[model samples]
Target: MALFVQPWPIFLSINYLGLQACFLRVFMKIKLNNVCIFPLAQILNCVVYCIFVAMAAGLPFLNPYKSTDDADFRHGVNFAVAGSTALPTEILASENILSPVTNSSLSVQLGWMSTHFNSTCKTRGGWCVNQIKYLSFFLKQSTYCVEKLKNSLFMVGEIGGNDYNYALLPGKSIEEVKKIVPNVVEAIKNAVRRVIHYGAVRVIVPGNFPIGCFPIYLTRFQTNDTAVYDEDQCLKELNDFSKYHNDNLRRAIKDLKNEFPNVVIVLFTIILIFCFVMLYTGFDVMSLQKACCGIGGNYNFSLTRMCGAGLPVCSNPNQHISWDGVHLTQEAYKFMTGWLIRNMLHKLQCSV
Candidate 1:
C-alpha cells in the first residue's frame, strides 16, 4: 500500500522525461538530415530513444476494433481486460491474453517489464525479454505509435478491483477492505493518467460492476448463514465496495475535469449506462447481476464451467443477464457497446 502512495508526480515526471528525451532525439534527427557535424551522435541518440520508449511502454497490444457485426463506428478499442480491475497486467497476461504493463496485477511480470531501461531494475537481469519475435514486431512500429498518440480512436480502462480481492487473501476484515477503497481509487487515477500520457483524450473509465455478485466470491465466502446473498443477486458487502469505488471515481473524474478543461472523460457507471440501454431500446433488465450463461450452479456464473461448449446457447442471449459467470455474452456486449457509442458520441457531439 505504501509503495503506491505519492508515486504519481514522481513516476509521472520520470515517464515524461523519458518521453521528452525520445521526442527530442527523434525529431532533431528527422529535421537535421545531413546538417550535423557528427552522424555518430545522431545514431547513438536513436538507440537511446528506443530503449527508453520500450522501457516506458511494454510491447503494445493489438488494437481491437469494435465488433464488425454492428455497422457503426467500427474503430473503437478496449484496453479493459476481462476479470481485471486494472487487474495487474501480469495476471491478465498469465491467462495469455494481456501483456503486463505498469498497472498489471502480476508482480513478477511487472518487474520483468521494469527491468528494461532502469539501471536499478537491470540487476534483476533478463527480466523483460519476451519471445524474440514479439519484441521485433513492436520495434518495427514503435515510432509510428508516438505520432498517433493524439486522436486516440477510443479508450477503455477498468482497473484496481482485483487489488481489493488481494487484500482479502491474507486474513483481512471488512474494515481492511474499506481502507483499500481510497487506494483503489488512486490506482484508477494513475491508470487513467498513464493512458493519457500515451495520448488518449476521449476516454471511457467504467466503474466496478457487481464483483460481490461474482459466483466465485459467493461460493468461496459462503457461510451456512443465509444473510449473504441479497435479492438483486450479489453479496451486499461486495456491491457496497463496488459502489464506493464508483463514487470515488466520479469525484476523481470531477477533479480531473478541473485539471484538464478541454478533454472528455465520461464517468460511465454500469447502471447509468444500463439505464440508457433500457430507455432507448427497451432491453429487459432482469437479473442484471445474475449469470445468463454459465456452467456454475443456478445463480453463480464462471469460466470453470463454460455455459455451452458444443451445445446450443441461449436462444436470446441478449435478453438473458449473465453470460458466463465472469462475463456477459457477446450479444450483451453488443447492446451495451451500442448504448455506450450513443452516449459517448452524444457527449462528443460527433457522428460516426
Candidate 2:
C-alpha cells in the first residue's frame, strides 16, 4: 500500500510563504467543489487512472531487467524536461515556463549517479538536443565513450509531469489540463520521432508520472472540508484527465511505430513510476503528504520546509520517501531505477 504518504511534515508558516497562500486560496476553492462529491468523484478518478496505468503496464518497457548488468547496459540517460510538455524548444524562453531546462529545469536520480554531476548539466536547448549532447560527449570521452559504450542505447525520451501542472496553473482547470495534455504528449511523441530520425534504434517514450500524487499539488489544493476532490491524492478527476492524455499518447506511439516500423519504440509504464513513488514516500503504507527534507507542519508540501539551506533533514533518510516534497530522495530514486531495470531494460535489449 505504498500509495499514502502520511505525517506530511509541512510547516505552518507555508500559508504566509511566497506563492503558497495565493495558490491555496485559488486552488482550495476548486478543490472544495470537487471534494464535496468526493466518493463518487474519487471512484471515477480511480477508474481513469487504472485505464492508462493498465495500458502502461502492458508496455515492453515495463518488463523486468533484474538480471541485466552495467557492462551490457549500453548507455542510459534520463532526458526529461523537469516540467516540460511535448512541444517546441523555444517555449522555454517564455515567462510562463515552469520546468525550464536551459537556465532552469534539469533533474537527477541524485545519489544514483556516482559522480556529483550537475543537475541541469545537460544544457537544455531541448530534451532531444540534450540527449544528442550526451550521445556526443559520451563518444568523445576516454574511460567510456558513447561509441564504445553504447552497443544499444535506451533513450528515455520523456516522462513529463509538469505539463499537467502547467494545465493546473491558477487560471486553468483539470479539464483544461485534459485539453493541453495531448499537445504536450504530442510534443514528446514528436521528440521521439526526431530521435529515430537520428540513429537511435531502441527508444522509450515514457508518459508522465501520476500528477495527482505529487506532494506539491496536494499542498496547494487541500481544504478543511473533505467534500472537495482532494487533488493531493490525485483523486479520480486528475488521474482520469491524465489517463485521457496517456491514451492519446499511446495511440500516437502506434501511429509513429506504424510510420517507422524499423525503429524500436518502447513506452515506459506508470506502474513502475507509481511503485517507485510509493516506495519513496513510503506511501504504499504511509502518507508523505509533507516533506521530510523540509521544516514546519502539514500543508502537504512547501518549499520553505524542503531541503536546501533553510530546511531540516531527517535523522533516518530512508524512512522518508521525499528528500524534497517535490522530488524523491536518493533511496527512492535507487528503488525506482531498480524498478525500471526490472520493468524496462531487457526489453530495450542491450542485455542489461
Candidate 3:
C-alpha cells in the first residue's frame, strides 16, 4: 500500500514469452551502482568487495544456469521465490523469484521510480517534476528498457493512496478526500495512456489496499464510538473511501481498454485476497489490529518512535499482517504473492 523501502529489494515476478522466468537482468547493470546509492551503501560496499574477492578466486555469478526445451503435454509450469534480505531463506526466495528462465535468454526489461505526487510533475517548481510531468521523464528514460521486451507488462500503480494520505493525514475529512478522487484517477489514466503509447501491451494496475486497516489510520481515527468500527476494528468510512477509489479506477481501466483495444489492462484485486489470507491463517480481529514490529500505544505505533533499535517486535510475525503501522510484513507479502499467482494469473493473462 505505499510501502517504501530502500529499492534494492524491489522485484516484480512476471511472465515473458509464455514462460516462467527471472527478470533481474534489468538490475544487473546497476547492481554494483545500487550498492553505493542505497541506504546501507557502506555495508553493501564491504559485501561487494567480498563478492569480488570470491569471484576472483573463480566463483562465477551463474554457476550453472538451466532450462528445458521439451514442451509439456498438459499443464503450464510456473516459477517463483519467497522470503527476504541476504540470509539463506531470503536469498533462496530472491533467487527463485528473480531468477531468469535461461542462462542465454535475456531478462525481462522494466524500470521503476519512487516519488510523491507533488514531486512527480503536478506543480513543477524550478527543477522538480510533478506526477503529471513524470510521464514525459519516464518515457525519455525507459525507451530502451521497454523496447527490449517485445511482449511487456507495465505495472502502473499502487499509487494515489499516498496522494490521498497526504490529504487525509493532515486532518482532512473523508468527504474532502473523496472530492479529490477524480484527479487521482485521471493521473493514473494518463500514466496508462503514456505507457501504451510507448508500447506496453499488458498492464496490471493494482488498486489501493484497505487503508482503514493500516495501524496509522486506526490510531489516528480511533474513537470511543464502536459503531464507527468494522469487524476488523478498522475505520469503516476510510475503507469505504478506498473502495470508492477502486470503483472509479476499474471504470477508468475499462474505458482505457476499449480505447486501446489491443492492450490488456487488469485491475489487481488485493482486498479479497487479504481477507482470505487473514481467515486462512486463522488471525482474528485482535491479532490483526496491531503492528508486528513497533512500540508504544494500542496499535503499537508512534508518530515519533517507529520500529527500530530498542523497539519491541512481536513474538510471531506470521500472525500479523503489518510490519509497522503503514506497511505489511515480509510474511504477509509472501502470502499475497502466492495467492496472486494462484488466483490472478489467469486474469493477468500469464497462464494458458
Candidate 4:
C-alpha cells in the first residue's frame, strides 16, 4: 500500500506538479506489481478543498447528512479479496445472497475473483490475487469507483488470519508465531489507511474468526491435554491468540480514527457474532468444528483429503458453519451479512 500522507515535501510536489506525476506513479506501481497506490498529487487535488475546510474547522468537519436525501444514498460494495470468505461462492451467489449490492439496485461494476492468503494457500487457479500486493487495484480501475469512493462503504477484510495461519503451518510454535502478530496488524493498518486516503468515508474492518473453533486448527494441533480445550471443544490457546490479534487490530483502528476522525471505521468481531448466531439458531455447536464437505478424518479434514468436488458433503450445509477447514458456509455468511447491514447501515449512511 502507498503512503500518500507522509513526508510533506514529496506529497506537495506530487500534487502541484500535475497529472504527469500521477501517471508516472501509476505506471511504476503497476510494474512493481504493487497496484495499491494512487498519484498522491491527483488524490490531493481532488480532496484539497475538503482538507482546507476540515483544517479550518478543526478536523473532520464533513457532515454525513449533507449530500444524503430521501431519494437515497447510492453506493457499491468492493472487497479487498484475500480469499473465499469475501468471494461470491456458487452456493450463495446462486441464491442471490452473495450479491447484496446487486440485489439492492447497485450494480457490481467490478467483480472480485477468489484468492487465498500466501501463508495458508493450497491452490491458486482463479483470479486470486495477493491482498498484500494489490490493495487498490480494483478501486482505480474505473472513474466510476473513484467518484463513488466518498459515498461507498468499504469492507477492508476478513484478512490478517492467513498471515498467522501461514506462520503456524510450518511447525513454528505458537509463541514464535505470536511475535508476528504486530507486523500483521501493521500491514492491515496500512491497507486501511490507504483506503481512507482514496476517499472511502465508511469502512468495516473485521478481525479474525476464532481459529480455536475451526476444524483445521483442532486437527492440526490436537493433543491429549484436556486443559487446552474449551467447553466448546475448541482450542483455548489458539483462540486466546486470536483475541490478541483482534485487540491489536482494534487498537490500530483506534489510532487511525484519531488521525482521520471524520471517517467511520467499525471494528467487527465476526467470531463473537458468529457464536451468537449459531446458538440463536439452536445448531449443534460440536458440529461447528467439523467441515461440512470433506472426505475422512477426526475433524473431517486431512492434508490429502480436503473438501473437493468428489468429497461427501454434509446432509445440509445450512446446519453447519464451516464449508472447509478455513472458509464458512453460505448460510453462515448470509446471516452474518444480514446482521452486519441491519446494525451498520446507519453508520454507513445507507438505507437499502
Candidate 5:
C-alpha cells in the first residue's frame, strides 16, 4: 500500500495546478524560502518548483532549470511546462485539436529528463555507468542512474488536463473528448514506465480534477435545463467525463503496479480532494464555482477578458476557489495541499 522511504530528493514531471499543490506542500515541508518571493505568473507557469528547491538547498535561485541554462540539480529539477499535455502534439492535431501554448508534452518532458541525466551522469553505451561526481557529496554513491533515482521521488502528473482543455474549449463534444481518455492515459502510463525504468522507487501519478466544478467549464457549458446540473451546480456530463478519465487512469496505474511490483505507484485522487473541499463548511460555497480574478458572466469568467489581462480581481482571492476561469487560487491550493499532505504522507511513506 505504501513505500517506506527516506527523505528522498524530488524529481518532478508535472503540469497543471493540481500537482502544483503537491509541489507546494513539499516546498513548505522543506521550509524553503517564502513562496511569495516568486511571482504568481511564474507559479502559474510551472516554473517555481526548481526555484524553491534551489532556494531550499541554499543555492542561487536564478539558475532554476531554464532550458538554456545549466540547471543545478543539487535538490531537484522540474520538467513541467505549463499548458503541456500528456498526449503528443501530433496526436492532438490528428483529432483537429490545436495546442495554442508551448509544444512540451509528456514525451518532451521525459526527453528533457533524459538530457538532464545524460549531463549529470557518466554514460557508457548510452547508459549511465557511474555515480554523478557533483551529486556524490549529497547522495549516496550509486553505480547507475536507476540506483541514483531510487533515492528520488517522481511526481509524474496532473498532466493530460490541457489535452482535454484544448479539445473541450474548441467545441469538441464531451463524447469526442471522452474518446481521448485512453490515448491520454496510455501516454501517462508510458511516462510512468519510463520513470520506473530510470529507477524511480516511488512515483505519484495524479488523476484529473473535477473540471465541471470550475468556472471555465461552467461558463462555457451553461445549460437552461437544471437537470443537467448536480447538487453542487456542476455540469453532470462534464463531471462524469472527468470520472471517466480518472477511472481509465486508475486502471492503467493498476496494470503498472502489477508489472512492477518493486515500484510504489500512487494514484492521487485530485477529484476526491476537490470534493472534500467543496463539501467542507469552511469553504465559501457561494463563490465555489466563480473565478477570483475575472470579469463578467454568471461565473465571473469571460473568454475575451481573461484573468491577468488587467481585469478586476476579487478583493479577497482567499475567499474564492477558482483563480482564473481554469486554475485554483493560492489559498485554495494551500488548503488542498494541506489536505493532500495529511492524506498522502502515509501512502508516500515519507516523514516530515
Candidate 6:
C-alpha cells in the first residue's frame, strides 16, 4: 500500500535528520510474551497506514485477514477494512448516514477474528470429546493457540472516526454528531472486551485523531470567521469534538483496566503524538493543513476531486503531512510510527 512520490533533493537533508533522530529513540526489538507482536492486527481505520506501522516495527507486511486464509497466522493478519466504522451499517442508516465504502464494521471484524480462532483451535470440551480421534495433534494445536493468543497484541481502533465523518459530511452539525460519542465509545469498549475474552493479554485502543486539523474538514467547513480556527489553523470546534471523544474513550479504557486487572489495556494517545508532529520544529512540513494530493480548495482539497482521482499530487510529498485531505502521507506515518514506538512501547508491558 505504498504511495510513490519522487524524492526531492532539497528536502533530503531534513528528512534524513528527522529519520536519524527517530531511529535513535525508537528501539524496535521489544518483545511481548517472547514474540515480537508488532505485526498488529486491524489498526485504526487506515489499511495503508497500518502497513506502514508494521513496516516501521520492522515486521513483514501483514496480509489482510481472510476467513479462507490457511491456518498460518505466525506472521499475524490484518482484519481492518478501510472506511469501516465502529457502528453497524444499520445503525448509521437509521441516522440517515451510510458507509459508502464498506459494510465490514468493528463487529464484523471481530466476527472474522472469532471465526479465525474457531477454525484454528477447538475448545477444551471438544478436545476431550474427540481425544480418541487425534489426541496428541489436537492437544498440541490447542496449546499453540492458547500461547499465541496470550502473547499477541490486539489494536482495536482509531475507529469511530468514520461514524462522525459520515454523519458530518452530509451536513450533520457538530452537536448532532456529538450525541453518538457514547455509543461509539461503548462499541470500542466492547471490542476491547471481546479481544480480551479471546485471550488477548495486550490491547491498544486508540482514540480518534484531531479531525479539525485534517484537510477534509478544513476544506468542507472553511470559514471567514477567524475565531473558528485555532492557533494551528485547525477548526476549533471540531478539535474540541475530537477531545471530547478522546476524553470519553480514556475513561472507558480506565474502566476496562479496572475490570481486567490481569490484562494490559493501553490507550494509545495518538492525538498527542499527532499534535507533537504538527508543532515539532524539525519536521519541515510546509503546509500543515493542505493535502499533498488534492485539488481546488483552500486546503487544496475537494470532496469530489479526491486523491487518486487523477488529481495533482504535490512535488515534494515528504515535505507535506496530509496525504489526500483525510489520511496522512507515508512520511507522516513513518514519523508517527517512530514516535509511537519510542513513547508507548514500554507501556505495552504485560500484566505480571
Candidate No. with top TM-score: 6
lDDT of 4 at 332: 65
Per-residue C-alpha lDDT of model 1 across residues 110-210, encoded as one tens digit per residue: 23213312322121223353535455545545534433333333233345655555555334665756765676577667655554554445445666666
**Candidate with the larger TM-score of 1 and 4:** 4
lDDT of 5 at 43: 23
The clash count for each model shown is 14, 42, 10, 2, 0, 0
Model 5, position 115, has a per-residue lDDT of: 68
* RMSD vs true structure, all candidates: 16.1, 16.4, 15.9, 18.6, 5.8, 9.0
Q: lDDT tens string, model 4, 58-167? A: 22212211123341112111222222222223323442323222221101111111110121122222355464355344334434434444544445555556556655
Candidate closer to the true structure by TM-score (higher is better), 1 or 6: 6
Clashing pairs in 6: none
Candidate 5, clashing residue pairs?
A: none
Clashing pairs in 3: 22-99, 22-100, 120-129, 120-130, 120-131, 121-129, 121-130, 121-131, 122-130, 122-131
Residue range 1-352, candidate 2, lDDT tens digits: 0000001000000000011111112111211111211132211211112112212222111111112333211112222223333443345225244544322121122112212112212323356756575666533342232222223333333444555555474446775456556666666565555445433455555555555555665566655656555433445455566667678778988998898887666665664476456744454245454555566545335634445565555565555555556665544544454445455545655331
Of 2 and 3, the candidate ranking higher by lDDT: 3
Candidate 5, residue 226: lDDT: 99
Q: Give one digit per residue, the lDDT tens place, for model 6 in 36-123.
A: 2333221211323344444444444554565355533454656666678888899989888888988888888777667766876775
Per residue, candidate 3 scores C-alpha lDDT tens digits across 207-320 of 777888888888888899998898867789988999999899999999999999877777776676777766686654576868876877788887677676677777866577
Of the two candidates 2 and 3, the one with more favorable TM-score, higher being better, is: 3
Off by over 4 Å in 1: 1-103, 106-149, 165-172, 217-233, 274-293, 300-316, 349-352
Q: State the RMSD for candidate 4.
A: 18.6
RMSD of 6: 9.0
